[model samples]
Every structure is written in structure tokens, then in C-alpha cells.
Target: MAIWYTADTHFGHENIIPFSGRPFRSASHMDSALIENMWKVVKPEDTLWIVGDFAFGPAAKDMNWLEMIFGQLPGAEKHLVVGNHDGELSQLLPWDSVSQLTEVEDNGKCNVLCHYPMITWSGARKGALQIFGHVHNNWFGSRNAVNAGVDVWDYMPVTLADIERRARKLPINKHWTDVEQRTAAE
Candidate 1:
């Protein structure tokens, strides 16, 4: 099965439209577009790792609606990594696999996946790639890391091989805290 990664969908959360400067006119529109974009690449046999923030605000509390949405989406092996918004979901949702961290090995390379961007993770110095979300695109990741959130990837899931290829093209992040401070000030 093909593998994919994405995070911070925030489905059914209306405030995200304006707060994140999303182009959608409403949450429903955003949700439709996100689903369409996701299914375009993700097939039934694929595996999609939703790193975190699958839903938020009102959406997170609506168990029935959330489950319906999951059912409607293409049937891929769905894995979850808990994020700040995903705290409630981690305990209740019935997913293929759910955790705060997951490790993946592809093309002889290992990737450490998580919801929040970390300064250091398992195998950081050994050249393992860190795939994360929660910062969107404001904070550039470390040399061996990359943001896997939809906001940085045209609002759709990205493949591991693609993430690896792109990470290799970026320059190393010299000061992690400095980048955090700059993004906060913006």
C-alpha cells in the first residue's frame, strides 16, 4: 500500500477559515475541497497518517458527524498521531492505529513522525527524518525534518518519498527558537 502523511485538517471548524486565511468561503466548502484533494491521490488501498488536529472546535465534539465523515472518505488505513487539538480524539476515535509518535522506514531511510515539531527526536543525529505538523509553514524545519501538515502542502496529504526529496533541498535551520520567535511576531 502507498503511504501518505498530513495533519491539521481542522474539519468543520468555521473559525479556521478566517483565522488561517483559508480561501474557502465557509467550513463546509473547506471540508469539501480538502476531501476532494485528499482522495485525488489517496486510493482505497493506501495508508494515510493523519498526524494530528483532524478536527477542532465544534467538529471535535461531534462524534456522529466525525465518524460519518470518516466513513465517507476513501477507505485508507488511517493512523493518527495526537496533537493539541487531538487530545480528546486520541482516547475515543476508532482508527487503524493511534499514537503520539510513529516511526516509518522507507527507501532505507527512517522517519520519526509526530504532531508537534521537535528540536530533537529519535535518531535525529543518525539522519532519521522528522515529519511533523502544528507549525504550518511559518517555521522552517531542521535540515532532516519537514512539515507534513496540509497547510504547507496545498491542503492535501504528501507522500514520504516526496517529503524526503524536498527536505534534501532545504537549508539547515540554525536556530530553532529564533525561527519560533520570528513566526510568533508575525
Candidate 2:
């Protein structure tokens, strides 16, 4: 079984438009494509790590729909690290429905898992790496971390090998370049 990490599916976000230029007119269109693509690469025994933003808005009535969609996914286990759009999900979701966020140290590597990216670079200094989602376009560098976001949602998912080699080099400092600061200020 392989371990996969992906985030920002935004399953029910009818407003979502892929950055890659693909067109999705409704949430159903996005949902079907996401699930089909995910299952195409996911084995029944594989584990999926969903970083955050599983849902679109702040309504608890949609829990049934959420569960139905997630239940249909093919995986041995699914873990969710809460994101900003988690909303009332934390309470309505069953205990077994989602995995709690925590720091993990495995195979001589340290990593922090969270929905929001932390500002500190403690993970790298401690010989750990942080895997996160949030900034969709910040997928560059070697040691820094950011989620691939739904805009670039790839059903194939990301492997640890890819994360280590690519995301590790991202800038760890909070000070953004003039371009970055301007984008954030917008």
C-alpha cells in the first residue's frame, strides 16, 4: 500500500475553476472528476492524507453528503488535517471520520501536518519537514512546504519522494519578495 498526500479538492465548490485551464461548470462535475481520477491511481489498501478544505461552506446539513462522497473513496484509511474551511465539520463528523492534526517523526525525518502553513522554520532546523496546503501557486523550492491546492488538483496524488525532492527547497522565511507581498496585499 502506498501513502498519498493531496489537498484542496473543494469537492462541493461549484465556483471552483482549475488553474490548469480545465473547465468545471458545477460541483458535481469537479466531484466526479476528482473521485474518478483519485481512484484510478489509488489502491484499495492505500492510505490517503487529505490536508484540508474538504468542503466548501459553513453548513452542517451537508454532513451526510460529505460522508457519502468520502465513503465512496477507495482507500484503507483516510486522514484529514483540518483547514480554514473545515467549519462545523469538526463537531458533526464522527471521531473515526477524520484524523487529528499532529506532528510526526518517521524514518529519521520530522514533519508537521496542519491545514494552515506555520510561519516558523522550526521543522527544518530540527531535521524535520513540514507538509502543508494553502498556497496553491507556491509549489517550488527544496525545503519549504505548501499544498498543491485544488486549482492544480491532480488525481494521481503526490508521493513522499516528490515532496522531499521538490517542496523541500521552498523559501522558509516569512518575508516575501516584493511580488509576493503585493500578491498577499491584494
lDDT of 1 at 184: 50
What's the CA error at residue 145 for candidate 2, in Å? 1.5
Quote each prediction's TM-score. 0.87, 0.75
Q: Highest TM-score among the candidates is held by which one? A: 1
lDDT tens readout by residue for model 1, 5-109: 888888888987777778898888998998999899999998888888888877668788788767656556888888888756543767888888989876677
In model 1, what are the clashing residue pairs, if there are any?
none
Among all windows of 10 consecutive residues in model 2, the one with the lowest summed lDDT is 175-184
How many steric clashes does model 2 contain? 10
Most lDDT-accurate candidate: 1
lDDT of 2 by residue, 1-186 (tens): 777677777677665455434467667877788888778877899877777776674332487887777776767877777777666653355423454465655445667677676644455544565677766544532345555454544544676676776655655545423223334544
Candidate lDDT scores, in order, read 0.80, 0.63
Model 1 spans > 4 angstroms off:
89-91, 175-186
